[model samples]
Structures are given as C-alpha cells and as structure tokens.
Target: MIRITDNEFDKLASYIQANYGIFLKKEKQALVTGRLQAELVQNGFKNFSEYFEYILADTSGSAVTAMINKITTNHTFFMRESEHFDFFQSEVLPFLHSTVRNNDLRIWSAGCSSGEEPYTLAMILDEYFGNEKGTWDTKVLATDISTKVLDTAKSGIYSNDKVGTMPTHFRAKYFRRMDEKSSVIHDKIRNEVIFGKFNLMEERFPFKKKFHVIFCRNVMIYFDEKTKTELVNKFYDFLEPGGYLFIGHSESLNRETTRFSYVKPALYRKK
Candidate 1:
C-alpha cells in the first residue's frame, strides 16, 4: 500500500473541497494516492507534496478539476435500485400530472455519471406517456462534476457490458446496437435529456425553476457530515414543495436541518 503522509492528505483534501464539494476523509488517503498516482507521474511530480504544491499554485487550472474527477467515484449503472424508477412511474408521475397545471415535468439527475441514470429515467418517462409526446413536456437534467464522464454521456454510446443489467425489451426499444459490442441511445429518447458539467459545491444552482424530483443517489458517501448536511439542505431548497429527493440507499440526511420528510428508506420529500 502506498502511504500518503498527513500533510499530503490535508493539502489534497483542501484543494478538492475548495474546487469541488467533495470531502476527502482520512480513510480515503490510500484511495486518493492510488487513483492520482498516474496524474502525479504525468505531471512529473515525485510525491504527493510536490503535486499538491503545483495544484495549489495554479488553483484555477484544469488540474484541480481533473484531480477531483479522478478521485471522486462515478460507479453507476442502468436501473440501479429499480424501485426508484417504479416509484417515479407509478407514484411521482401521476402526482405531478394531477397537481401541476402544465404537463411539463422536470427531473434532475444530480451526479449523473456516464448518462446511465438519466437515460434510464428518460426511457421510463417515454414508456409511461406512450405516444402523447406533444401533450407533455418531459425531460431530464443530468449533471456531474466530471467533464470526462459528461463527454462520454453526450456521445450516447456504451459497451454491451454497461447495458447488461437492462431488460432486453427495453434495450431493444430505446437503444440501437452501434456495433458488435456497443450500443447507442436512440435519438428519440436521447434528445429528451440534457447533459452538463456541474460541481455540486456551488452555493447556487443555475436554474431558475425548481425540480419536481431530484435523484442524487450514491454520491453523498464521499462527503463528511457537514458537507452532507449542507447538500441535503440545498437539495431541499432546489426542489419544489412536495417534490421528491432520492438519495443513495446508504445515505441519510440529518433530520433536524432538512425539511424533507421520509417517504421511503433513503428517500425524502420536501415539506
């Protein structure tokens, strides 16, 4: 195991937290060092300290963004926790259709890595509404901190392995096989989602309108308690009243500060 010194870890953590909202914990030193080793070597730094100095000196450079992307985990897949999709289609959509005057329903796939989650949501929405495309405006806003992942997401191409977990019929309906081992999201469904590069640490979300549902699954595990509390509160503020927030199955908000009431385990609704 490559050991990261305390000073080295602190420097990297501060840099990451300042640039991105991600908080590196003491236990993650080894993981950070391992993941960023190549970058360090590529930049011609002998150790973490030298690399830290270089990044600190050039705080506004792409190096900071690249470092955050490398260190943050982006592991995600289609239909991850199928229950959430079921809830969205059966429970959330109907509620929105009846309550909101406009047929438009906006959902935010926060920390949407490599496009799987947002695409999955798009497919579900397409199936739910059938051919009534003109009657309703349904779209997904997918954002992530990693430009690398967002670039791949914009291409709408994925290897067979990435789609292995999706149902065969749905895959056939929404995706076209690009080649022997790859597939691309069909244009109809692909056009319904907008992908952008966003850092969650920003105090203000750029959108003027509030989202009806926000899926921020599996991204909070990297943050500490203070960061998690602040993020949960921010999500609450960004969501419309009675809107839903879906977090990772393993993550929970500090109940006192968050106005969201628990609807399901790991799921909350803005009060």
Candidate 2:
C-alpha cells in the first residue's frame, strides 16, 4: 500500500473537515490510508499528495464524491437504533396525528445511508396511518453526502444479514425477498422515500417548509463539537415548533445553550 505522508494527510483531513464537517483526527491516518489506497492506485497516482492535488483540480467534482464515499463511514443496517423508531411510533406519530392541522406530514432522514433508516421510517408511517395513509402526505426526504450510498439507498436492496435485525412484521410486510441472500423494499413503501445528495456543511438550508420530525442519528459522530453545534442549531431552525429530533444514542446536546427541549437520550424537541 502507498503510505500517506503527514503533510498529505493533513491537507486531505483539513479539506474533508472544512467541506463535510467531518473531523478526521491524527489517529485515523491508518483508516485514511486503507480506504484510499485502492483509489490512489486506480487513478494512477504514485503518492498521496498527487492524489490530493488531483482531487482539488477535478472540476467535474466526481472525484470529490468518490473520495467522500470512501472517507465517510456508511455502516448502518435496518433499525440499527431501535429505540428511536419505537419512540417515533409510540409518541411522535400519535402527536402528529392529533395535532398536525393539515394532512401533510414532513419527516427528514438526514445522512440516510444505504436506505435502511428511511425505509424503516416509511414502514412505521405506513403502519401508523394504515387506511388513513391515503388521507395524509407521509413521504420522507432522505439525503446523504455520498452519491454512492445514495444510489444504493435509491435501489432499496439489502443483504439478508442486513435486514435480519428488522422486526419480523416489518420484514414480512415491507420487504420482498429478491433472492436467497437479498431483500428489496416493497414498491409502495419505497415510493414514500425520496433520496437526494446533500452536504451538511452548506451554510444555508434550502427547505421552504419545516419538518415535523428529523432523524439525523449517528451522522454527527464524525463531526467536531463546533460543527455539531452549528448543525444542531440549524436543525432547530428547520424543525417545526414541537417537532422532534432523533440523534444517535452516543451523541448529546447542551440544554443550557440550545432552544431544543431534552425529551430523552438522543431525542430532543424544538420548543
């Protein structure tokens, strides 16, 4: 494997942090080297610095996309964090059903990787609304920074092991066995999710309407405190009053500094 020099690593790390809000520490050098080694060889680069320079000059920006797909960790599986979904089904959906004035419901799965999270949400919404689903708008906007993952997410296919953790009923109802080892989301459920490529580092949000619920779980673990704080605050603004934000269990927000009300671990509500 081609070794990444300290200078080259620093430059690449800084670029990723600045553009993606991901904090790549010194300890991650081995990870960077491993993930990028193939790309370096495939692109005919003799050294990390040369590859870095090529990335900076690639006007098509596909190089950046490819780099990010390797750099960003996208290891999510169906219902990986089950508690959030439980809370959503038991508490959030009930509240929305009772209080939301119009039939329009908006939920966002930011950094939705490989389709699992958003697909899970879509299934929950389908169950919650049941026959009333036709009366309400219940689609979710799923976005991620990696085009590669977005493509996978759009296809909504998962290996059996990946889908194994899903609840029995959810698996039975929403997914169709594509083969011996893979399952694909049902068309009706799949249609409820719209996937897009989005970078969290963008200063301004472009949404015309605020979300009723935002599932940004596990996505911010890669971000530094400053980046996470800024991004959380942006989430606050984009959420409807009383809207809920579900983050990863490992993450936290300082209640003293933010407008969101702490509902539980990894869960908050815009007050």
Candidate 3:
C-alpha cells in the first residue's frame, strides 16, 4: 500500500485547494494514495512529499491535473436526473425561446468531465428543437479543471460502456459508431459544444456574455462551505436573471447562498 503521511496529505490538500478549489479531506489520504501511486512511480517520486514538492515547484504540472482528475469523482451520465431535463424542456427552454431575441441558447456545463454531460445536453437540445441541422445558433460551453478530461471531451468519442445511460433513440440519432467499441458524437451535436479548461476557483470569468443554463452538478461537494458559497455566487453572477442552475441531486444551496432560489430538489433559479 502507498503511504500518505499527515504532512504529505496537508501539502497535497492545500495545493489542490489553491489550484482547483477541491478540498481533499483527511479520509481522502488513502484515496489520494490509491489514485496517484502509479503517477508518482512513473514520475520517479519515492513518496507523497516528493510529489507534493514537484507540484509546488510547478503548479501547471500535468501531475496536478492528473491528480485532480483521479481524486475528483465524476459519476454522471446522460440525463442522470431526468426531472431536470424535463423541467428544462417543459419550463426553461420555452421561456427562453420566447423572451430571448436571438436564436442562440447558451449553456455552461461547468465541470463537464469526459463530455457526457454536455453532449447529453446537446442531444436533448437537438431532439427538442430540431436544430441539429445547424440552422440555429445554439452552443454549450463545457469546462473542467482537468486537461485530461477536457481532451477526452473534445475528442467526442466514447466507449459503448460510457454511453450506456443514453437512450437507444438518441444513440441512434445523434451518434455514429466509430469502431467496434466506441461511438463518435455526430458533427451537428459535437459542433454545438465547446470544451475548455477552467478552474472554478478563478476570481472572475472573462466572458462578456452570460449563460442561460449552468450545469454544475457533482462539483460543489468537493468545496468547503465558504468556497461553495463563493462559487454559487459566481455562478449566479454568470447567469442571466431567471436562468437556471442545475446542481447534483445530493447538493443544495440552502445554506450556501441567497443569490438563487431553490425551484426544485436540486434545481435553482437566479433571483
């Protein structure tokens, strides 16, 4: 078993928090060991402290991104919570379609790891609006701190196993089989999504345009209460009024922030 001393854990946790806003707990020491052992060995580091030193020396190191990707649990799928999509279709889209002057609909999949979440959103939009022909100006911006996952997401290819949650009709309609084991997202759907590397801990977003829907699910669970509040507020600022914020089913903004009002169990609207 890989060993993680208290000092090593603290160093790593601090580094991750500073760089990615992910607060690794003491219990996660073992998890860190399990996930980064091979990386340490590959990088010729004898122990966790040495790896920590390497990270401190170069915060932009790929090791840090790899570590973040390993530690951050990305348990998401196409329409993981069906109700959110139902609400999006039944309520959010119609309202936006009517009130918004342009044909453009902006969506931000904030922690969209390996592309499933945003691609799933793209498929839904195409299916619901019949805009797959590229006649409409719709786009989904998918961002993640991990360059590894962002690269995978940009590739827009997934093993059949990773796409198990996708509906049969959607799979047939929006994806083409790339090979025996993987499928490629159709160009119309793939082009609708733009993937980027983003650290949510950043003080400000550089974009002039705000988003209509922000899907930041399963990400805030890694942040502390203060960080959660700050991030939620940032999300609120990044959204247009009445825009929707979809978080993980297990997460809530009850005590996090007042910038958004809870619309459903895990859905919130900017106020």
Give the clash count for each candidate: 0, 0, 0
lDDT of 1 by residue, 142-197 (tens): 99988889988999999988887899988889889888899999999889999998
> Model 3, 1-271: lDDT tens per residue?
5588998788778878876789888888888889988888888888888887787677566766677777777666677887888888888888887776567788999999888888888887887787433655678899998777888888888888767668789888988887889888889888889999888999988878998899998889898988988888888998988899999888988645376887888899988
How do all the candidates rank in terms of lDDT, highest first?
2, 1, 3
C-alpha lDDT of all candidate models, in order: 0.86, 0.92, 0.83
Q: What is the lDDT of residue 122 in candidate 2?
A: 94
RMSD of each: 1.8, 1.0, 2.0
Give all TM-scores, in the order shown: 0.94, 0.98, 0.92
* Runs with alpha carbons beyond 4 Å of true place in candidate 2: none
- Deviation (Å) of 123 in candidate 1: 0.6
Worst 10 residues of 3 by lDDT: 129-138
By the lDDT metric, which is better: model 1 or model 2? 2
| Better candidate by lDDT, 2 or 3 | 2
